[model samples]
Target: MNDSKPTPSFWKTPFGIGATVIAVAASIYLYIEHRNHLLALLPYAFLAACPLMHLFMHRGHGHGAHGHGQRDDTPKRD
Candidate 1:
């Protein structure tokens, strides 16, 4: 029974820690530097999110709790 677990990846190494810190710092710096530019896109971002949110939340929607995926004899919506 080969039960050996896989080795830890990048995040577990010292170099990875440094890289993560640099990435976070760069992100914060860029956001602060271009805060106005990012803010200008908020409305478009909100519009884009509507359809995405609807698509995810509406999965298996008509199928409810007990009657999921089973079709009804009558062509009527429950």
Candidate 2:
């Protein structure tokens, strides 16, 4: 039986060239269409989101790798 995983193709990969191109294009379009709105909210939005983003990220990753050691919280038997 084959246990190996198949590698992702160009578009299938996360944050690949295609994704980057799409994101850049969208950003450019938004900037052109809503330059004033973007300018007004960009800084405040970033500042407002910074603390919440940090809390969210830290909460999500607080446990160490390997899911904080064990699936069951109770002590394990030998």
Provide the global lDDT of candidate 1 against the true structure. Answer: 0.85
Residue 23's lDDT within candidate 1 is 98
Residue-level lDDT tens digits of model 2 in 1-78: 999989888776776977889999999999999999999998999999999998888875435645644675565454
Worst 10 residues of 1 by lDDT: 60-69
TM-scores for every candidate against the unseen true structure? 0.45, 0.49
Q: List pairs with backbone clashes in candidate 1.
A: none
Model 1: per-residue Cα lDDT over 1-78, one tens digit each:
999999889898899999999999998997999999889988999999999999898986655544766666765565
Worst 10 residues of 2 by lDDT: 60-69
Candidate 1 clash figure, as a count: 0
TM-score of 1: 0.45
